[model samples]
Target: MRLAELSERSGVSTATIKYYLRERLLPPGRRITATQSEYDEEHLRRLRLVRALIQVGRIPVGTAREVLAAVEDDSRDQLSRLGTAVEALPHGPEPDESDPSTAVGRRTATALMRQAGWRFSLGIADEFPAFRMLVGAIAALHRLGYACDLPHLLPYAQQAAQLAVADLDLVEEFTTPAEQVEAAVALTVLYEPVLLSLRRLAEAEESNRRFGGGS
Candidate 1:
């Protein structure tokens, strides 16, 4: 299709599509003439991914470039591609390992992972993006005078493990690496609210059962 058709199909403006091409977020279309280019399904797929990352995921352009590179890198296996994409996400800001308080949190975080047997790549667990998120949350909870102890965290960790398995199973349901990787990215960004809402609803039900409170 032409640029106009692409824009219409994607529900994005032609100006925005031009911007994406200029930014190299979307691959350049095939040259049909000196001034015009032809787009195909591949361009559409890439455009959708770019839009999802930038619009829905709110990923910065530089980060999206890195993530798109990771996603399109056919050299790596599918799992590696998924990991690379995940590493680019803002699970938490870069950790301050030098800060004593952050170090304390890191220790607790690692301890929790250890007790839960949450296996990770050797020496890379501490560097995982979510590791920083966990450390920050635990540290903040400690500052709030809450016990960020294993007993309280173990069930969450177990549930996370189960969720990971289920997520991977869903990813594996797609046969192609591209489809699987895209599913992983989409689910990672989109499903957190679903899980969080379910948790809250379950808590409410439990509260009602125990306290006999009105909805």
Candidate 2:
């Protein structure tokens, strides 16, 4: 299809598509003439991915570009591609390692992972802000007089690991490398809120069952 059809199908404006073309976010369509080009399903898919990254995931264009580049780079293996996509996500500001709280949080995170026997790549925890957030949550709970020791947290870690395996299995279902990359990116960015909402609902149901008055 032409640019107009691509824009219509994607719900993206032709002007924005032109911008993406210039930014190299969307690959050039087939050149039919000096000024005319035609796009295909691949372009449509890429446009949708770019839109989701920017509009829904709230990823910066630069970061989205890096992710797109990683997705398209056929030289890298699947794991490397997924790692690159993850690394392109925005993270919180680096903690001051010298701070006592930061030091304690890091130590707690390390201990929890060790006790849980969670196998991870070297330095992966250090690079992931989500891990740091987990550390901070544990520290905060401890400060509030709640025990967040390894034994207390092991169940959650085990459940999360199982979920991660399931997520990877879903990614493996896509036949093409591009489809797998798209699936990985979409699931990573989109399913987080769904998971959190489900957890919240489950907690509410459990609380109501245990504490609510008969009605």
Expressed as tens digits, the lDDT of each residue in 95-171 for candidate 2 is: 55555666676787788788777657325887666777776777667666687777788888889889889888998
Off by over 4 Å in 1: 96-99, 213-215
Identify the runs in model 2 with alpha carbons over 4 angstroms from their true place.
128-130, 136-146
lDDT of each: 0.83, 0.83
TM-score of 2: 0.87
lDDT (tens digit, per residue) of candidate 1 on 1-215: 99999999999899999999999889899999999999998788788888888888888899888887888898998778999987877676665666566776778888888887766742587667788888888877766678777788888888998999988898799788987887788778777778889999999899998899656
Separately for all candidates shown, the number of backbone clashes (residues 3 or more apart, or on different chains) is 0, 0
Error of 1 at 71 (Å): 0.8
Q: Which consecutive 10 residues in model 2 have the weakest lDDT in total?
A: 90-99
